[model samples]
Target: MPTKIEKDSYTGTDTTGHEWDGIKELNTPIPSWWVWVFVASIIFSIVYVILYPAIPLTDSATQGVLGWSQRDTLATELAVRDEGRADITASISEADAAIVEQDHTLRTFALRGGAAAFAENCAPCHGAGGGGRPGYPVLADDDWIWGGTLSAIQETIRVGIRSGHDDERYAEMPAFADMLPQGERIAIAHFVAGLTGKGDPAKAAAGAVPYQDNCASCHGEDGTAVEDTGAPSLNDAIWIYGSDTGSILKQISNPQHGVMPAWEGRLDPVTIKMLAIYVHNLGGGLQEDAGL
Candidate 1:
């Protein structure tokens, strides 16, 4: 199916001598506006090549009139950002314990920063939200194996629990099986369970003295925990290892020591403060809106 038109008609242009079903087609030149647009595009592309970095060379790109680079832009942005943080670093580092304790806005910002660092560094063991895993102590609860006080928490963060660091809170829960008779170990386990309202009274009464002598120094006088010693409260249902007889026996036989990384070097002081507050607020520490 082909169509043809007269050689010289509307615009004095030649037409093919062919037709399909008596229908003819005209051969007209491109419109003046369209032709001009096409030519302008080619010229604009050449100018663009000269103005911007569009052409690729052997090892580098063509240097345009404006020498712009992604690295330079990033560096400028980072410099501007760091300038702001630099001025605040002193105030943040020297922030009083009381100010951190009372200030909500400061606490919120610090917590957010700490949360990000915790997700990246502490989440592997403590979990993303400080919920804690099997061996890791839960930071999201009031049951801190160590003290829940801000200072105590900060010290713990600086030194770490059971760390060989000079100021680390040191005291291993002795394997009672080595010191006490097997029968007495059972009795103590029963006593410990009884403290948490899980064991018989008669057995617990017999093991009370042993519990006091062997466990009280760290676990507190009433099995309520010693924040200074990082000892868990036997009276509470929360157990670092487990609450079962077998678990208790194992704990009694071998002391459990869980390690948390000292975040001092890894994160800034302000960040650490924020994280401590964030974790403390999770379930353990003082709250602003709620009355005790």
Candidate 2:
């Protein structure tokens, strides 16, 4: 059993006076201010429990007077953002879809916007400035295997050549090795080179008849290119593939069929229109005053 010690009148406080031999224990009093603060804190806790979400219930937390929630806050923020974006979306549409890429201002807008979009989407294959990769076509020059006019380019973008579009531009440059003798193939290649002023006149004269029958369908009667056929003009010295003799010979032996994916379904109409205008203005845009 624990023994109770009487109060010491000298120290003026209650205590268990029993102690180790010759040592006395002292009783200390807490300050009034500290005690008052402790009491106030207890009272504040009680008030908080009643007015705010403090204790957990069976299925949910207690609802606070503020009525604040994370989910509700997010929803309100999204509504505000949508309201702000409405105008930008409307402006994109109002930029004119049928500008024909002739208006300088519209064309400039398209070029800037389209260049950004192209770098984001097409730089992996077409290069950052449409400078052509190992397999893709260059878009910065006048050389175009599939026409260069605004409508023509728009059509190409809508339905790519050799792509799975129903109305895609389609052509097959046959291998002369199978159709004509090796010498005749060489002669035709020489003729094509001559059209670009790069071949011997005698070889060109020798291959002229063969070139007229086989190559004229797309390259045109004078090798000037039939725009409707998507054949590049040979007289301009701008070769879509290459102008080197070896490259020409290889192309003559086995023609190239470049494929570009159709972006009509992938991009919106306004975006596609902008892209067409941008590409037209890159090197060869038909003037509005031109009877095109």
Candidate number with greatest TM-score: 1
Model 1 ranges off by over 4 Å: 1-65, 199-206, 286-292
Candidate 2 wrong stretches, greater than 4 Å = 1-85, 91-96, 100-109, 288-292
Give the 10-residue window scoring lowest on summed lDDT in candidate 1: 283-292
lDDT of 1 by residue, 1-292 (tens): 3344467655677766566676555666799999999999999999988887888889999878878777888999999987877745555568965476567766666677678877987788988788889988888777666667676677778777666777776667676767898878877778888777877778778777887888888877778776556577887777879887668767887767777666667777777776676677677864434322
Question: How many Å off is the CA of 141 in candidate 1?
Answer: 1.1
RMSD of 1: 4.9
The per-residue C-alpha lDDT of model 2 at residue 198 equals 89
| Per-candidate local distance difference test | 0.74, 0.73
Local lDDT at 59 for model 2: 95
Clashes of 1: 0
Q: Write the per-residue lDDT of candidate 2 for residues 187-254, one digit (tens) a residue.
A: 88788888778877787787889888888887887888886666677677667668765677788888
